[model samples]
Target: MNTKMLHDSICRRQSIQNDYERIKSSGSEANSDDDDHEPEVNVCRISAIGLFVNKFVEGCFLSMIMGRNILYPFFGIYLNAAGNSFNSIPAVFATIWATKIFSAIFSDALPLFGKRRLPYMVIGWIIAASFLFSACLHEYPEPYYGVTNCTRNTSLVLNPRASESAFFYVLSLSGALFGVGIATVATDALTVEYAKREPLKTRDKVLAYLNIAQFFGALFATILSGFGLNSTEYGGSWCTSYIDFEDILLIYGVLCVVCTFFTLTATHEFPVDPKKLMPIKDHLAGIWKTVQSSMFLKMAVYIFLSGCFADVQSSASVKIKAYYAGVQPITTGIVGALNSFLVIGSIVIFTKYFSNTDWRKVTIFIKINIILLTAFAQLITIFDVVRNQYFYLLADETSCTLFLGILIYIAINLSAELSNESQEATTYGLLATIRLLTNPISTAIGNSVSAPFDVVSNDRYIRDTKEDQWSIAYAIIATHVVNSVSVLTVYYFLPKNKFELNELKLQSTHSKKKGLVFVGVISVVFVLAITLIMLSAVPQTQCLQVVGGQGCSNKN
Candidate 1:
């Protein structure tokens, strides 16, 4: 019996030793795999690069739309006078904001058609390009650039009968605006989704690189278009009679289509299991929770005010044309291009060495500078307000653009930190919605307040004197002052180490239907207000330049 017991004990001890070795070996192998996961890391970077390319193309398209190049400015000058482009600014942005909201809402829900973001983006691009193509069919008459038809060699002037072409022209404009809205929303959401898949450290770098690419793309487009804006004397492709503006649309349209194809083919969707899809109720509940958060509300209001200030400043081209005559589109393009370059450089430097604490401090300083400098610039322009050098405007604009770029960088990072990975896109979309509303809201206010002063433009709107435009300038400056104060309030609510803190995961108890109804009511009311302004507000008549045998008049 003793011999048998001893043998069993030895066998049991040997078995235990073998089991321990196997467990130890498995853990060691796992640790080794974790340390040497180069393939996985490399794959993430490759995917990030693809997204970066997609954004670069988007940046180019946006630059073309926003740049003070011949195309966009001509479009503006045709629809309204170059000096009075701000007249219909409210309506244009109302459309954009409405479409953006729909696109952002639908982007998350559109996975039923296939990948959530890519398909919508492709469709949006197609729609946008198609509309631009249609706009190409009509050319801005000769009166837009100068009173004479030097290139076309005809007596044709900018049509006083815009009502004749208003229908189709407006249709094409709507399409472009809506298409841009949808495409922008989808692309923004996709970027957030892609970034979430990366580790935190890598994700920041990825966003930084992508933003750099975006600025580079904008810079490239601005430079390319600057040559075109300057092409008036040469009368080449950028000239009205040459490519006829229609072909330019075709060119950008085709570019968008081609880029869309490449983007669809190159980018991969982050895998989402069907079973993990949240029900509509849960999604609404989640959104409601986010909306109810005090921090988010404060941020939203701040963004709205900031956007108000930005819209006025973005209309600087009009202000420049009104104040400093002979500042041609080419000159505007040059300043815009310079601003883009400086913005890129500033972003690179800001990201390179700034810690979180440093970023917060720098962001505050930039915000203050943006407000003060913009107010000073507007006041100077308003009161005549001082006889300053030409470069003063450029310096102010460039500095503001630089500050804006830094704010965008910091804001994006702050947003990422505030939201969880699961709902990052939705959070961003909501924030963007608030920011976008400022466009129409501020423009409407500017239009209504200055209407009494008759600073609005007529068909042949020409800048007469600084006195005629000071009211409008003052209106814009006042908004900046208001925004400066409003924006400062947001900083207090921002927690310390916000970018490093965990997201606030709230228990959503708000009634989804009530929340939806509330949001709907707000949107409807805002849209109604904009429509009322558009219908009632009349464009103020201003004197026209007497040239090529045309006489100056009160109403064109």
Candidate 2:
């Protein structure tokens, strides 16, 4: 059958099957004689082609994370060590961000080409791979620059400085192009297409699963960078020790290409006649209409602000590591994993309990609380009430930072969900655009805001120095305070309604009862285990330090 006919057939069969299942489960009995004469149930099956397409898309996602998260950091470190300034790093990233604007525009336009998603994805991947490969060879001396005349003979002299500059330019350009190809409009569109098959009730779960997959991909990248790049042991020579970085980039590029091919080969689109396809102008008009919605605008603002805060936090990662000189990359990876774990848990819980309630109120409340908590954390950090090591350890062990992160993440998720209930893909695309726009702006602001403090405090020179650490703390506090107030203002001015509280109460009670019982048993076991470990592990001086740190030395 033709593609349209096949789609119609599938739809009819699915509808009939659903109706039959509903009747069967409702305890309706069919006449015994009529049962034999009934039409055969045609099971709705996902085609082999469909499965292949899904897998291919998933693989591309996996590869993108590997390249962006895993390889990029190592590349950044290498470029920095090669005499590039800290400022240059942001410029490189900014270039990547700038390219995404073009990617977004192209992605939105590609469907007009009459080709399916696969061609766009394939071409993008090819571009990404080619640029990445060129980036790998960036350190090679330029032929023209190396040509020199010596005494009575023509000779070649390698200009290492010229080679370094050439390499940096190539690396930056490749990174920018890669960002344009893989991370922009195509990813958002793919995610929306995936979610279209799922019911609204399961949509959040589907997104959570995708996010989880992305997190796992990031985690894998972190591990690969730690081990493959030999970051700790071989800190020098981008071309030498960091060859694995290029290898990873190439691998991900190959995966992207292969997956794109699979997607093309396996997926078929039902051909829409010109009458059926939405006109380009109409679609653009719809985009404008969607953008003008008050809810969408509010959500867009909230996400932009939230992203600004998050960008600051992300930029602080290197600085955090600098504070703890002996900390390993593996430790950082573990912390990241812990954060993801907590975030996943929070999303699950929120979906289970708060989903049936009014998301708007819950989102607003959460944003307010996030601002409060962010401010509080910053205040504590600035006042020296929370030491960096202790804060990091607490964040690591108990997932405190993860908890806070999820509070903010859930707000953004709910806001996005609420803004475009009907046109989710477009809503999310806009949200992504807002977020992308904010990232570089926020990063630039954060770097600028943090610079004077760094210079004045001479934080780099001081090891184990508590005096100068307050500069960052103050910046964090100021930013969070501003963020909180802005959200509060938005919450106040926007519409308000009493969401049903009883369902939430019931869910809370149920969860609390179960959690209390579980925690009580676990607490006893945990106390015993900790006591045992402590008795075995502690020395007298260390015990005193631990006690003092806990503020229990005098209490006992």
Candidate 3:
């Protein structure tokens, strides 16, 4: 269902983090190596090029060459070939995002070229572009590379790629994710800094702007997927269909470079006032100060648990949509773009009409809407109601685009408010890390829970038997049942509104050890998910052999 970013600083950051804690506890300040360095010139400042400049850049990165959405089918199928389940795909890619905290830390402490985010943003894009270009030249398992270099190539279902080595394929993808990921984080970091300039009442506007940008990116990805790579099988016959997925990637590589260049020219990283600057150690220590607050801790827990609860989506949906339901790429693309448009519309409507509504109610409404809509869609899938492509958009994702568009901004607004202004990224990234870490844990739990129903992630669509349909349906529904439980918890975890948020007193009773527990949790999930994906060349799924399935093809 999802994939994500990676990190630049691993070893260096640990030493830095540990030192910050140690220094904080000992009540002494050691002169950091950069105490005497000249004040940063490029400085952290918003650009005159446009309103929501960072938002625009970040949005472009999301949909443009980033390929996070477009490549989902390809990599999900590829990972399935290598023994990863569809449920596990999001978690695995989420590891890249899990590195955001570290990337945030690297930006906060290291301060590349007297600046925090810009240097990394530019450099990260360069690396990502290189990998995208490199993937074009790499010889993937020829049989599984999709139908003749494009055309309904969303992961060759033949399972031929499973029998071959995926070393280079994984390497190239990883490199791109790592590069683009850190850059994306840096871009977000830039936005976070910019967000600090706004008052709480209007800060959500910045996030809303960013959300619109993402939807815009989604719109682009849809057109490309529908018109470009889609072949006759996926209902892409409307176009001539000349370019391959690689051609798309080649375009992305160029766009990545061009976009990074835009970042350089479009905005300047204004300097932080010297009076506001603190010792690097103090800044790191302040992460504790912010996250240790009872409100922030509660928020982190809610974010983790709500998101982590029921993420048991499997690849069976792909086959069902593509084969059983006969949904074509053009249909998918058209609806996807339309959904993005709806989300933008909803955001506008909400900001204009419901801006005064309690944030808590909005959060709860979104969760409930998610529960009902997703279940309704899945129910249609299970019962074969209509068996048409448009129903999926109308029943399932329609509300998603309408309601979920404002969520990222709300999340940013809430976390930004909780964070110390001086250590914005550190606090925000710490919270984002919790959300990131939840994907894998939730996926693992959801799939494991759904296992008893005999649902599977890599069910081959070529088989025609309907005997296993009920079990798969049951498994899918079970995930929704678990997800519905998350809505109840939000009332207790979140503050009523921004007023209550500002009123809550930060509790100093918490210690560094408790804070490290959160860090430890992050480390555990990151390592486990990465290890699972790394060992994926050997089968790790617990799929049962069903009527229409090739369970775990990588199994020896």
Candidate 4:
């Protein structure tokens, strides 16, 4: 009887394994978004591997590029040294917006070449890395000055601020390239295309892994940036010889090139017949139809409102680094790496457990608490009311708040329901455009409000008075408070149920009317004017006739 029981248990286990494989193989038929057929098992396996490798390699390349930008505060100092600390914010916004616009345009157009995304992906990576490489050509007139407020006799005298150079413009050009080259907005659509080939259960698992991998990539980038770019200790100095921006770019560029090759070789996209490829006119029509969907509009509005805060965290991190004691380049890097690691952990937890639940109440409650705590943290720091070091606490709070605040996953799901697989790239790209618009708007508001109070605009961390420090802190606090309000909209507006077919079939005539065209144009004009006017108002310092430096090109 014991032998019989053991044989029965083994038989049941084998049966369960075979059933699981059948469910996976039948996924395409059950969740059929585009077609009502089954994909061959071998083809499905190949596609899954391709997607995994593509994402991993993309992550590696992204990490290398981000490593160079680990010293954003320093970059801001350089801009200030050039006489207008805020000059690049507008450019950054414009480039990002333009890239989204192009990515949408290209996503549809590139299919004409018998390919959809892979070719553009390769080209975009190359362009982004190549332009970032231009930073290598930049050389500060003086070496990077340590920002210490020490009054000790042995302390080094404050060096003059770096003067503006053609290299600055080159860096700007590179940013534009980067803006166009970082083609991540299309990755989700690609993932969905592959997921469509699998069954429901298998698809969910694949998507979860895909998201985890992306977050892991971002975390890796942060860690890589921290240690790869800056020299933590060199020749007994905290600040010593390290890789230059250009050198970092060169390394990133090479890695991107290698990754691009891997992507092209490893990934196999479903073949599209030339006859069936959507023409330019049809593509535009599809985009218009997708835009008209109520789901798309709501998602866009919500994402725009919440996404603006995404840029604020970095500036806030910079503030903490500037004010906190002993928070040098290495410290900033370590904190960033740690924060990213936590972000990855948060993503994993949310994807696995919290994602399918109606967490609306929970999310709002958390946001409210975070806002209060964040306000308190900033206020105490600004008022000089507390001498205790709370950098880690503040960073942790900021990370948790952001992770809970934004609802990109929900937005993406909503978008997918409104769009067919063919138009997924354009649909998601449009969302990306909305998100990109937030960057400039937030930057303009943040900088303009803070500009009047910015007393110490150069590279030095010293303040003549504690009031100067208060101004920076207040600006950061105000920005946070204003942006935080947008998170509440998600709780209020987001639907409780996953999108269904019945909702898609309903035709709302109101959606077809292009209402935002005039308002959007006006908004664009206004934002550009505000950003340009503010940046121009900041007085630029004239370049001294230092060797290998241009001596004041702009007389204005």
Top candidate when judged by lDDT against the true structure: 3
Scored by TM-score, the top model is 3
Predict model 2's lDDT versus the native. 0.43
Instruction: Give residue 187's lDDT in candidate 4 (0 to 100).
Output: 54
Query: Per-residue CA lDDT of candidate 1, range 163-189, in tens?
Result: 334345545656775776777677777
lDDT of 3 by residue, 1-556 (tens): 1111111232245456556655654564443322222221112324423323434544544553333344433443323332224445455556665676777777766677778778877887798889989899865443343454445454555545443434455556567767767777777666666555444445566556666776676677677766675554334443354666567778767867776777787655656556666677877677766655666667877888777773445435554555456666666677777877887888877766766567777888888888888777766765666567778756766767677756654666677677766576677778777887777666665655555654443343444346566665666677678887788777778766554565563332565666677667767877876665544323443332321124456335
What's the TM-score of every candidate structure? 0.75, 0.61, 0.80, 0.75
> Could you tell which candidate, 2 or 3, scores higher by TM-score?
3
- The residue pairs that clash in candidate 1, if any, are 136-246, 380-385
Question: Candidate 1: minimum summed lDDT over ten consecutive residues — where?
Answer: 542-551
Q: Of the pair 3 and 4, which is ahead by TM-score?
A: 3
Order of candidates by lDDT, top first? 3, 1, 4, 2
- Tell me which of candidates 1 and 4 scores higher on TM-score: 1
Alpha carbon lDDT of each predicted model: 0.55, 0.43, 0.60, 0.50
Better of 2 and 4 by TM-score: 4
- Candidate 1 is scored at a TM of 0.75
Q: Mind sharing the TM-score for model 2? A: 0.61
For model 4 the local lDDT of residue 34 reads 29
Better of 3 and 4 by lDDT: 3
